[model samples]
Target: MDLANLHFQNPEAFFLLLLGPLLILDWWWHAHKRKSTIKFPALAIAKKAAKGSKVRARYIVPALRMAALCCFVVALARPQNATEVEYTSTDGVDIMLALDVSGSMGTLDMLTRTDQAKLGVMNAEKVLKSGRFWDYSRLGYAKNVMAEFVQKRESDRIGLSVFAGNSYTLVPLTLDYGALLEILQAVDDSSASGNGTAIGDGLMNSLARLEKSDAKSKVVVLLTDGIDNASLVPPLHAAEVAKALGVKVYTIGVGKKSGTFLAFQQNPWTGEISWGEQPIPAENSLDEKTLSQIASSTGGRFYRAESKDDLEKIYSEIDGLEKTEIQTIAYARYQEKFYPWLLVGALLILLELVLANTRFVRIP
Candidate 1:
């Protein structure tokens, strides 16, 4: 017999301990208690009768009871042997990247101010600030950073959203990073005609997109520069909706009112031209307080980005934060062990009864 197969939850085997003392006590009590006395006219007749009959039957009740108890005790310990098995499955993460494409996003924070145009700006500051030129559009910065973030997660399903005065889906939730990047790269400030920021609408759109996902983990990355200005739905209400559906939203506030570069453009085809590069002032200062509250309400974090570098670092951190759905399988296998013990107990009890009534039986 395999020792492992004879497992007991109570390792002390308490039933065995009780049975030993009980059997011994029962045997001793019976031995001293039962006595046969004869009032005989002749002593010789009584002696002759005692020699013909057995003094007492030994070992029947105690032996049978001990055997029965042992079998029953062993059965109480549920035991099973392990068997190896194989398992296979697949799962991934779902993420939505909601970006603000409002016109104010053309704020320029990249490259050192140079030439006579950069004059009056501190020269020592310019000398210290020489860096690579980056496109000065909120959409452009978001596209580049999100591209990098998505590239690192091959197993995750990604989607895109552009929210301005209104919101619209640029890409539905999908695993095709190629298509997502293309849509994100093509995004321009012209996508939104209204000058307002619909931050709440954007979050609501992302939440609606994830409603059917059924993914183990769902997330929304909302990047915006303004408050709930043009949105019909309020940011807090949208967050409550997300909480109801068990989705986490990470909010990124882009652009600061002071010292960030801003670029203007001309529609050459319409012959309408706009001039000058200025520091982009927040139409409404980036709502860090509201954004932080949104993140906190849903077990997420808020990040503030005033420069392209800050945006890049934020994306790297968010990439690290995104988690994949996990799946697990459990099983229970039981072996029927009680029947054998019950059968043995019944037979032992029956044998005890029969020996008491038959072989060792006496006439009244």
Candidate 2:
């Protein structure tokens, strides 16, 4: 039991403290009334006798008695040291964050420091050649936003999975947000096998992790920036499986609607290299139709994030949508602190009695 957390079970008993001062005042009043004086004509014999007596030391006895009374009063108030403990039970949402780590995620189109700063992105690396700030890659922005999203969920059990040519669970469903954030921060384009995007494989992997979850609600937030190219199972079939299993899927397609990407070409005969910027048709690069179908099939919404700000809003909207239900029970355990006080009070009273009867004995 900690003395710092002391309390009183019977706090009303503290009213007894008023009696100590009253007793002292009554003793003083009686002592004043009993005061007597006798006139003496500057007698040297009387002065010598007064100087030899120890009358001032008698006050110590009353001071000791008053202290004992104060201690006794505090003990009667039932001093105790209390420690409170809380128990929480939750019917929380179980979520799986399905992320794409394909080679395309390394695109620098989304890496604008101005947009990243506007979106409140943290820990962005500057691309420096001539001493200038550089923007973050798609994977970098995703990681920062996802880390922020994970920190907002306090009661929900969250998991992470990444996919490219294949899919793997990075972290299982857990309440440990710190550990989850560490894994999310470590994720980059190279974290997974960089062959091709596997949307269906990623969704299936997320579902596999959530298959045994007994939570009230199960959800998967699948974010990708490219179309499905290497998935063995079709994306639609994966959505159908999720719908049958009562899982909701929210799909987010990231990147600009239309932009040009740098394409490189090699001349085999001349051993010459050439590169040029080519217009990347958004429709061909991103399979929005299939992503929308996957979302709607499982009673979820589809989002298109054109910029970092749009992505942040998308996550905030999802956070407001999925709410966890939690209940907390608290109890306190108390240790009685009155015994020591009572013993101290008794010892003080015994000491006062011994002193009053021996060294400070009074005669009437």
For model 2, give the 10-residue run with minimal summed lDDT. Answer: 126-135
Tell me the lDDT of model 2 at 278: 57
Pairs that collide, model 2 = none
> In TM-score terms, which candidate is top?
2
Top model number, lDDT: 2
User: Candidate 1 regions off by >4 Å?
Assistant: 1-90, 110-134, 260-282, 325-364
> Residue-wise lDDT of candidate 2 within 255-345, one digit each (tens)?
7767864334456897554444457565446788999999999999999986677889999999989988879999998888899989999
lDDT at position 339, candidate 1: 69
lDDT value, candidate 1, whole model: 0.74
RMSD of 1: 13.0
TM-score of 2: 0.68
